[model samples]
Target: MTLFKVAQLARTAAARGSRSYSSGMFTNAGYEASREHARGAVETWKKISLFVALPSVAIFSYVATKDELAHIHHLEHDPPKFVGYPYLHVRKRKFPYGDGEHTPFWNPLTNPDPEE
Candidate 1:
């Protein structure tokens, strides 16, 4: 679902909160009721987010892990389709400042994968 739809659902849930704030100090039952409502809303949002997030995470991991495994297995073939989003790696190259041809510009040992 869209973000606006999610926001609308959250707003609706918030509107359903039990008891209204009065000018006086909050009571124990009122606090309990408010907490309960908030907890319910949180639980609902958690389920929705998991449903949306888990599959995408699985797909991303599958594509990434498969590519890494392919490399380890001495397979020089290009990774399968969907392994990378289009133009995801299209960025300006950063060359070394000096003409130190002996030095590698980017060090994999020191530079962590941007994906991580």
Candidate 2:
């Protein structure tokens, strides 16, 4: 028989004061109550997931759009300087043959003293 028909029979038997009928009715009622609780829990979880997901999606979208916003606003930034060994040494060295050609290093004979 279908669950509904079984529950109906159990209820009728319980009303007649039969021990067997009482047990069946109580079991059916408990099952129905548990099912309701499970459904409510699932709904609660769905609401919680939506709350969590919406903010995460909004944050990700905002981060992704930052570059586009910067481009539209014509934002410019200088390139980062290299902090590693070779690049640091290269930057520190003054090019003797370049703009400052009169520096002592460029004319070794004029400043023969190495300390100079």
Candidate 3:
């Protein structure tokens, strides 16, 4: 081919490649914008769902277990009275060495103190 014709062909090819590249870049930018919008929508929906669902669950749970909750509150506030058995009597015993009148003897061989 002639040198002029080859140069012309190269110029046309370069122009076509540049146009295609610019169009592709625009398409990519459009896709990025779309994806960003989708992400924003999803995040907004998540926030809305959380706001709606948490209160709904809390209200439903409170309503469903209201009786049990009241019972628990009553139990906490007014516990049952404890009644001692007639046969189980607790006696307060005096320690032998506690008073000055009943002083301990200094016998080291036998451990006389019940605690020791």
Candidate 4:
């Protein structure tokens, strides 16, 4: 339609969109209500985790491992010697630095020594 009518319509639309139901000023009542709700939720979740979830997990773990624990036994003999099979323990090239005999973080308990 006319430019004046279009401008008036746009102004009216913008005013309606900007209108708010709540007061623009901050209020202590709103802050207190939100804080109380958040505190109650935190306490409820803490109680559920402490009294319910933790104990349930502990009981489940114990029951599940009880049979395995009873049957567990250490090996009577030492581990088998590392037979020099090309495909099995393939060490293509030695390390660039250090003695290059064993890995940098080699643990005798877990990892077998190359010389063994």
Q: Which one is best on TM-score?
A: 4
lDDT of 4: 0.73
> How big is the RMSD of model 4?
5.4
**Candidate 4 segments whose C-alpha is farther than 4 A from its true place:** 1-27, 52-77, 87-98
Could you tell me the lDDT of residue 17 within candidate 3? 88
> Which pairs of residues collide in model 4?
none
Residue range 13-104, candidate 1, lDDT tens digits: 88876445453326887788888999999999999789978888999999999988867564334323334557654556544664332235
* CA RMSD (A), model 1: 16.9
* TM-scores of the models, in the order given: 0.35, 0.35, 0.33, 0.46
lDDT of 2 by residue, 48-114 (tens): 8899888899989998899777754543343233344544223355556656424535433322322
lDDT of 4 by residue, 24-43 (tens): 23588877888899999999
Segments in model 3 whose C-alpha atoms lie over 4 Å from true places: 1-26, 67-116
* Residue runs of model 2 more than 4 Å from their true location after superposition: 1-26, 63-76, 86-116
What lDDT would each prediction earn against the true structure? 0.66, 0.63, 0.68, 0.73
Ranking by TM-score: 4, 2, 1, 3
**lDDT per residue as tens, model 3, 64-85:** 7997788777766765554555
Candidate number of the best lDDT: 4
Better of 1 and 4 by lDDT: 4
Q: What is the TM-score (0 to 1) of candidate 4?
A: 0.46
